[model samples]
Target: MFSTRPRDADAKQFIAEQKTLASIDQQVDAFHAAQPTAPDPVIIEHPIDPVLQTGDSQLLGGAMEIKSPWSEP
Candidate 1:
């Protein structure tokens, strides 16, 4: 009786939310479809030379100096 308008408004809001979700789903599907299908490389074939190899003069080897401007708690 008196609750008809509120019920209609709630239904309209629910439909609008569902439509927005559907649009987002469609956009996500389109983006996924546009991506390259080729399988990415998993392993590194060549060996890399280490920066802190053989002898380490300081603590954390070159990590602290490499990532300077850092704060310690």
Candidate 2:
């Protein structure tokens, strides 16, 4: 009787866990459905040219300084 009680308790816990997982899955599905689709990319006729090097004249061993466009000041 003691062994059966533990087994029954474990079974109930497993069922409860499964129900929680199912609820999460439903919420995720609903969220996905509510999201908007991505828009198409636009094409331009003439794109602006990118700057290759910095205007700094003084440098060690004549090495050019490279800078990233996304870097913050």
Candidate 3:
């Protein structure tokens, strides 16, 4: 007769496999819901003017300047 609780290696392995199968099924369901239905394209405009560009070197260089310690107090 089988015990109320699992008592053998085969019973433990069966429980583990069942849990693994359940986890895999949950992941599959999530992935199916996350599937993309259509392709989306990104359109961007690149500026040609050197100084007028979004991240010009002059602007970023000045932004990195260390301020005076006296300004903190």
Q: Give candidate 3's whole-model lDDT.
A: 0.64
Give per-residue CA lDDT, model 1, range 12-45, as digits (tens): 9999999999999999999999997754444333
Can you give the TM-score per candidate against the true fold? 0.46, 0.48, 0.39
Highest TM-score among the candidates is held by which one? 2
lDDT of 3 at 43: 40
| Order of candidate numbers by TM-score, starting with the best | 2, 1, 3
Measured over all alpha carbons after superposition, the RMSD of each candidate to the real structure, in angstroms, is 11.4, 10.3, 13.7
Give the alpha carbon lDDT tens digit for every residue of 1-73 in model 3. 7667646877889999999999999999999999965434444434355555456554543222233333233
* Model 2 alpha-carbon drift over 4 Å, by segment: 1-5, 43-73
The CA lDDT at 49 in model 2 is: 29
- Cα TM-score of candidate 3: 0.39
Between the candidate structures 1 and 3, which one is better when assessed by TM-score? 1
Ranking of all predicted structures according to lDDT, beginning with the best and ending with the worst: 3, 1, 2
Clashing pairs in 3: none
Output the lDDT of residue 44, model 2.
36
